[model samples]
Target: MSAAAPTSGPATGLLAVGAYAPPNVVTNAHYAARLDTSDEWIVSRTGIRERRHAAAGETSSALGAHAVRDLLTRHPDALEGVSAVICATSSPDAMFPSTAALIAGEVGLRGAAAFDVSVACSGFLYALAVGHSLIAAGLAGRVLVVGTEVMSGTVDQEDRNTAILFGDGAGAAVLGPVPAGYGFQSFVLGADSSGGPHLYLRGSALRLPAGTEMGPYLTQNGREVFKFAVRTLGDSAEQAMREAGMSTAQIDWLVPHQANRRIIDAACERFGLPLERAVVNLDRYGNTSAASIPLALDEAVKAGRFKDGDQLLLAGFGGGLSWGAAALRWWGGAG
Candidate 1:
């Protein structure tokens, strides 16, 4: 049987948003006590001063569930028709069971097609695309897409390169029908696997052996990833804008993954967008991997920075050497 095309039934877009960060906060001083880094140095380099870290036993699924629940709390009716749950995460609670399944159960989703999408920092955008497609295909009336990560669990605290750059958090959005011209207008998703070796985790179910000394931890060639990110982010954003027939002059807000402030600034500069238009929280949250975009989005929306009928561009790029961007017109407050 032929697969169904994405449904054109109703215009589907983000209907609600929620975000969560674990209460435990870690400051540059905390890392300074262990690593050979200072607050001023980290700030000057990565623009990060503090980040939230998940407490013991708090997994990515738990963070994600909290975020979804927060969304549901504001728009309880959102749960009434949820048909699928798409979780995007780099750090999962386990190698199996999929974090989406755990989150689905936690948020009272029963029998919904729940699964996880692993695209590293670009996860939210990737999951957003999948959620959008599901709604467009008419397979799901409503979908919950979440990007959550306990990056604290994945990094080696003693390693200055990766340790100082990650945090723990989650963000979620509910997707449903919206009025025409009010949702996603275009998307750009691409990958350059050749750069994958520059950033990756070392252990997995297949390659990891018992009694091995190599612990599961993230590693990165920062200079390589940085170069790739700046170029890819700009390219992805421009491509999406082109597809959407939008000009930089028309974009009201920019929400790019919060990897590094410098990267965000570079991409905005390439797009001819001023830094003021971008939503950035990396200084306070570090790189929460997949959770960064939605976390920033939720904060922006709640803070009244966005209004109805604003043109918004969301972009992300990271490991997998993957990148994605989407153009959407804001509809404002949940319906």
Candidate 2:
């Protein structure tokens, strides 16, 4: 079914766009106290300075609530009758209840069809697609698609490789019916699960098999993830652009996962998109897992950079060695 999503202005429709990010910034120097790495090293390799993470007693649900709360406040009318909530993440506060359920509860959205999706860094895009499709199928008039992660809790504190790369944050968008020829234009998603082992967790001890203790840290093949992210991310972006029936010349913004500057630069270079146009915030947020895209989306729109009718391409690549991209036609109208 075709998405009736209008694209001229914010209203009576879907993905009116919203997001939230915490204020805490953890510099590499901050990690220096807990690990053996230096700020210079982190900067040289990751193009990062400091990243935002949640405060003590904060959970993924709480940070996500922060973003959702901000979105509701900014566009309080958007959720007046929203039908569903889709949260995307790998670092859910609990494995059983799903982050969506938690968020719905937090918003007092009782009985809303809330659920979670896990596709690593590609999650936001996946959830975005799901939200769009759900509306297109007439299943819901409006959906709040969110990406939240509190990865600090899963980092292997002793392992300097992965510990320095992740932080916590969340972003969201309100999706509803639109006029036409706007909103999500096209999407491309791909994964190489065989490489899942390259970046994976051993799971919490509480959920482990008998005699299998919970691993105190996350693990990864840093070099492999780095290599795959650069190559696959570029390819996936090209595919998404092609699927959207657009050319590299038309992309107004490239909001990619805030994992590394080098990777972001390489993907832009491959697509011939200027580096200045692609949103790069890793230096401040590290890699907020799924939170990266929405975080970047929010920043771009708030900066007055994203204008009406601008073409925005969102892409992401991360653990599970996943990659995704989507094209959005900006509707330059009132919110």
Candidate 3:
């Protein structure tokens, strides 16, 4: 799927962004003590030194609400006319009542329409596209897009494959009208169901790949997923940029999903972008699933790395063997 240029009129762009990570830090040392691995081995392979684990009772909605509150505090009027809330996650607090609905209640969005997007790491971009469309279609004045995950809740502590690679966190953005030529340009998304066996959380409802059995934990073929992500991330970003009538030199930053340092490096190389041009934080916070891109975006925004009119390319690839990329022109002066 892909989005065309917005309808003629005001453009929809991110008004404000926010993120939150649980205080409980789980360092590589912590994993080393339990798993048959050392910090050097983990860091050299995944470039993750530590990750945040939500404390007991901290759910996805709670984390998302905190991120929304943080955004409100920074941009006090960002949500004044917000009419919808979109949450993207694979680790919802429950299967019913939707995480978006739960977050709306937590944040007092009493009458807002609420829903969820469950495309794993690519979910944030998917949610952003929907929010942008809602505003462009005049169905909403503003929309709050949130990506939150309590991945630790679904990870098997005994399994080193996923345990050392995931963390818990939330990131959010308030989408509303912006001046012409300074908002989202295009969004490109795609999926390959045949690759589902490469990375996924086991569930009874999903058909297994022959001998595979379902369980309550995340399972992955790390090598296979790494290959898929490296190719998909770059391909999606290029398609989005082309759709936006842009070239690589016009993009200022590449905010990619914080899955693995190697994957980011590979994707950047394939996209003809220097590694330093990419925003990364996986060393401090391993992949937070859907929250990865926004978390990195919020951090960069806070650091004042982006200036008005700067171009940005956001890309993500994960379970569902799905991928999404978007081209955006920054509008805000403040973080």
TM-score of each: 0.94, 0.90, 0.96
Per-residue lDDT of model 3, residues 28-93, tens digit only: 999899999899999999999999999999999999999999888889888889999999999998
Candidate 1 has an lDDT of 0.86
Model 2 pairs in collision: 5-178, 6-178, 6-179, 13-176, 13-177, 14-175, 14-176, 15-174, 15-175, 308-332
Q: Rank the candidates by TM-score, best first.
A: 3, 1, 2
Model 1: clashing residue pairs? Answer: 7-136, 7-137
Residue-pair clashes per prediction, in order, are 2, 10, 0
Over the stretch 81-134, how does candidate 1's per-residue lDDT look in tens digits?
999999999898876799999999988897999999998998899898899889
lDDT at 20, model 2? 67
For residues 1-335, write the lDDT of model 2, one tens digit per residue.
11222222332323455666677877888888888889999999999888777888788888888888887665667676688999998888888698888988898787899999988788998888778777767788788888998888888757789888988899888877665656777777777766776776666534533343355666677888889888877777767777777788888888898888898888888878888999887888888888889888877766778777778888887666677877787765424
Q: Tell me the spans in candidate 1 whose CA falls farther than 4 Å from its real position.
A: 1-9, 205-215
What TM-score quantifies how close candidate 1 is to the native fold?
0.94
Model 3's TM-score against the true structure: 0.96
Q: Which ten contiguous residues of candidate 1 have the minimum total lDDT?
A: 1-10
Q: Given candidate 1, what's the lDDT at residue 277? A: 94
Error of 2 at 216 (Å): 3.9
